[model samples]
Target: MNLIHRAGWRRGILALAVASLLTLAAIEVLSDEPEIALLIGEPYKAMRQRSTASIDPAIPGHSWFNAPKSDARLRFADPQFGFVTPLARFFTVGFSRDQRIDGVRMSPQIEPLLLDDTLKVVLDLQEQWRNAGWVPIRAEEFPSFADTPQWRDRLREVKNVEKAYWRAGDKYQLMLVVSRFRDNKRPTEERYLITLGIHRSRGVQ
Candidate 1:
């Protein structure tokens, strides 16, 4: 072959090699296991930073709801809170992907975590809030939530529900709800849903 033809052949080989490398990288990113996946990039950085973006409400004692250092991918602020509803902005974690949580929208892509791992998250949240002087309210205390079938079912699932509130003088009270559920489909493909929300206190106005 002439020099020009030889050069063209070399260029084609180089392009083909680059394409193969890119394809392999994409596969590694998509097929990463859960424990390693969450620790890979920005989400891991946020977790290490112990970001409280979603939990830090405008109310007092927000510092109490921070996620545990061992956990990652904990999101508190629902992306569509004030735009869609007047209710206080919500919080949730453990979903494989983020979802619009205006108290109505639910996430289908739940993350599968073991029961023990799920409880660790809930206890972490409850401990911090309790230390900050937030009082745990009984179900009967909030007739509206206690009476709702949806809330009742959610509470019954795994029986891991925590409801508490903290007051900021007389201005307003921040109500907190946290729950975790396992989506039992396949043993190897287990998933769990850890949800949390902050709303205006049930009765105090």
Candidate 2:
């Protein structure tokens, strides 16, 4: 090959190598830290905004619900698993202008989710809170998991709203309710609303 041709080929090879390196660097940066806000969506954003406004005296410290959206300590709202609480410190609070349900406030703009999604939320919350001494309770109005299988098929097919109750420590109580309703924006589709609240226990401790 001529000297001129050889020089052109070397330049082309070097340019391709540099481009490949830049592409790899970009991919590494993106994979290292994904966007938590985009992963969770508007429900998370709305709850985060309200986390600081209403304080629950029973909690008595920095609210995990108030954690930044990107905080590594929180995980929630998975489509396949419903909801996940990998870290016990990651918590959420719900409040609204609407009437309270069983003495706990509800959010007016509750986001619709899938039944599977809601189930996962309840399960994860129950598991984490149980580790913290929150015992499951049976009630006429709400669903109880005490006797049911931890991994059950009957509950996964449910397409309506359901509620669960738990008591923690000596004075605090937790309530979680999941409602499946029609999507306002997409009328043909159905979605679930997963609301949670914490309050002073009214029952005998």
Candidate 3:
């Protein structure tokens, strides 16, 4: 009887240990944050579903919209988390001909009213990206503002424009454009327009 009781107790403890491990595994899976790199090649429907479900409605200004001029693209703006850059205003995903995600772009808006705070956030994000293995791309790899029509049009009125580019291996690229302009209405006052975009490397697609 003693031998049988000891064997039963050992089995019970083993079962409890297994159960505990399973529980911990489940918690880890549930707590895992969504990653953009993982979503890059997924189908549009699956990406939308996963992204929508992950959004926290409690986050102020969080919203979704169909990206203008493209039915295949979906945009999530001001999400609670899971963005490479903090305080991002928009996370736009573009689909390829086969309906799989081909590209993702995220940008944080620089609030005119809160310029000081927003600039600090932008600097912090840049540091985080660099620490996470992103390196500046060569100047020759990007187009000159004078040669790019779109950029010329965008910065026509700006006093000066500064551009920076970064790459993460050959998988992704990041662009930062900062334009300083005099407020048209208040010519004495100056303002800044900052745009940041991250794109999947064309070779990877």
Candidate 4:
């Protein structure tokens, strides 16, 4: 995906309002990819969340409500199997179509490693997600490693958003990361994305 960045200035408390408008304007004329929000009109239950009858060491194969986690913070059983601790947390809030929130509060108690030193702030207050401990890793560890099998089996698929755009203005930027995580497609997506964003992107720092 080709990311676009725009610069802006704020006026006052109404700065948010101004920036939001400018962001919309930038997006309107920025690129030529007809706006297509990821297909997330409906949510499917991950197989794992479907049956909690037993402490299924085998990570769920279904969706959440179907096999709910005792701790909402625990995004996956073997985080390596999916987005690690904090990353899992950040990606889970809107994972379900039902609990989608436009904004999320960053966890003051965030993992230092997960924090993108370059991008610095992973997801800003209005960025839609916050790292709650879930981290990202290669998908091979999970059974779905072969193909990222299903959304429930792939960590990347879980993090993908339906509609995301960044409005760069100040210390805190407004951005959205849309699209469902690749279901077990590329096992090394995190490594690839990290390499791309950090090594390829210039202003990340």
Each candidate's number of clashing pairs is: 3, 3, 0, 35
Displacement of the residue 146 alpha carbon in candidate 3, Å = 24
| lDDT agreement with native, every candidate | 0.40, 0.47, 0.51, 0.27
lDDT of 1 by residue, 1-205 (tens): 9999999999999999999999999868544322211111123234424443323222232212222223223333222211111111222322222311112122212354554554455556555544544555443564213335575465556666556444433322445454554555655533455444444344653
Compared with the true structure, what per-residue lDDT tens digits does model 4 show for residues 42-102?
2222322432222222223422322123222222222222121122212222223342221
Task: List, residue by residue over 21-86, the lDDT tens digit for candidate 3.
Answer: 999998686445343322455555665455423432222232232332211212322122123443
TM-score of 2: 0.43
Best by lDDT: 3
Query: Which wins on lDDT, candidate 3 or candidate 4?
Result: 3
The best-first sequence of candidates by lDDT reads: 3, 2, 1, 4
lDDT of 4 at 49: 41
Off by over 4 Å in 3: 1-38, 53-65, 68-83, 88-91, 113-115, 139-157, 181-189, 202-205
Ranking by TM-score: 3, 2, 1, 4
Better of 1 and 3 by lDDT: 3
- Candidate 2, 1-205: lDDT as tens digits: 9999999999999999999999999878644542221122233344334332233322223223332333222323223322223222233333222312112233212255555655565666677665556676665556554325542444444464456787654555656765556677876655655566556576833
Point to the candidate with the largest TM-score.
3
Candidate 3 CA-lDDT value? 0.51
What is the lDDT, from 0 to 100, of the residue 188 in candidate 3? 64
